[model samples]
Target: MHNSIERTPIRAHLTDHMVIVNAQAVETGPTRRPAAVLIWSTTDQKIAFSDPKGNLLFEGKAALVAPEVIRRLRTTDSTFFSLNFEPGNRHFLPLSRLVARQDFMPLKFDRFSELSDELQSRFELADYKGIEELSDELALTLLPRTNAKHLRDERIDLLLPLLESNQPPELNSLAQMLHLSKDRLSHLFADDIGMPLRSYVLWRRYRRALLALQSGEKIATVAHRVGFYDHAQMSRTFLTLFGYSPSILKCPKFIRISGIQSN
Candidate 1:
């Protein structure tokens, strides 16, 4: 049997810290993924998840695959578009809801055609900044009004850039700077973000590692730059987070939304 090849030209757009990739596959292929993925396909693509030994776990058209899932794809030529979310970002509210479930969650929505059209146009035109603006607006609308004090105290909105930087400020230092006790700092992070601070740091490091690897950096260089102890440590973290070693990863081409100038 011939390997299912990615036939159509694949394009990616980054918006709201999410990477959306559009591709059409001509046949079935086996591949490993490192992060959680949500697929919205124009057609019901035949997708499957299996164990390392290839035991089928799930199959469907639309899937929400958790991090480190080894999946096999089997499908005809179809519009298979997917979004890769940066972990620990609560802004991905719609997609985050599915994280608590199994690695793969199948979905069916009749309105997918309309949604796909809008998304396809945006990606094709590389309108990521527009998408980011809309997402920000939506996030503001959804943010809880009761949490004004929390927002002010936590300052996540302001600290996001620092958090994403190569040298993330330590929580202890941040706590002292903000005049919050360590316990209060921890509580605030958990309460507002639904994740621990250390976990958030790890996710950020992993995110940077992925981006660096995509930019054609060597594994050791990426590991060091992202604050890992070494390439081995980074590889271990990568395997744990993505279910595949970085060696097997083939980074996709993407247009970073942050790189685009706002219109």
Candidate 2:
């Protein structure tokens, strides 16, 4: 008989405005690890994600993802609990990298058709505490140096800073400065990051919009400030991302991102 495997805690990146909690639980034998949980702004709900932790996490490492179609991994059956984090985009990761995945599967970790055993084990569990640590570990570990893709790195670098700017710049300008065609830029983004540039842009913007709302801004004002099309636009994206409306997440209301609100 084999002894049970135990995992330590990991780190996660965070915004001054937002907080991220890592996945925590213990399960045994093949079980579904929790995917991502996104909480958008105040609308109907935010679009929760279960994708690759984004390209930033796969920087300069030689890790492995479970392949494209494998989907989520099954927790050891002996006894294992999980602690899931929230609010990020969704992407399919190979065993080289560690990321949150969805339920849809032919579950896999390392090589497919070889589960209910020890094959796909990649995350650096240091100390299971909070979000900042998890985000940091993720950023540091997953995103190592792959190759010389300055533009790709540069583009991703823009995100944290751009979001911090008082008046964040638009995408077209960045594309222009990079001296690359729009399609080409998008292609590079997808290549390095997995998802298209526009998709991450949306996630980044929506994250900001939610922050504004959390600060007690009006719907219209928050929408305008965060560069949304309008309140309706914010509302729709909120619902899409969080699975709840914007008005509900207010501080006093204090809505939890995990629950499903009834009509």
Q: Model 2 — which ten-residue stretch has the worst lDDT?
A: 39-48
Q: Compose the digit string of candidate 1's lDDT tens values, residues 1-263.
A: 22322244455454435656666653223455434566656875565556656688777677666654566544455777676655434444334444546767666645355567776676667787765554344344333555333333346555556677667788888778778888988877665655677777776676667656665678888788878779998887766654446664434421222232211
If scored against the real structure, what TM-score would every candidate get? 0.68, 0.47
Candidate with top TM-score is 1
Candidate 2 C-alpha error for residue 153, in Å: 3.4
What are the Cα lDDT values of the candidates?
Answer: 0.58, 0.38
Once all C-alphas are superposed, what RMSD does model 2 give against the true structure? Answer: 13.1
| TM-score of candidate 2 on Cα atoms, chains taken together | 0.47
Q: Mind giving the per-residue lDDT tens digits that candidate 2 earns over 1-263?
A: 01212333312223332234222222112212223322111111111213332212121101122323212122222222112232222222221134335222221222211211121122232222333333334433333366232233556555535544435556676678667677776676666555555555565666666556656668888887767778998777766654345775444333222211111
* Model 1: residue 20 alpha-carbon error in angstroms: 2.2
lDDT score of residue 17 within candidate 1? 53
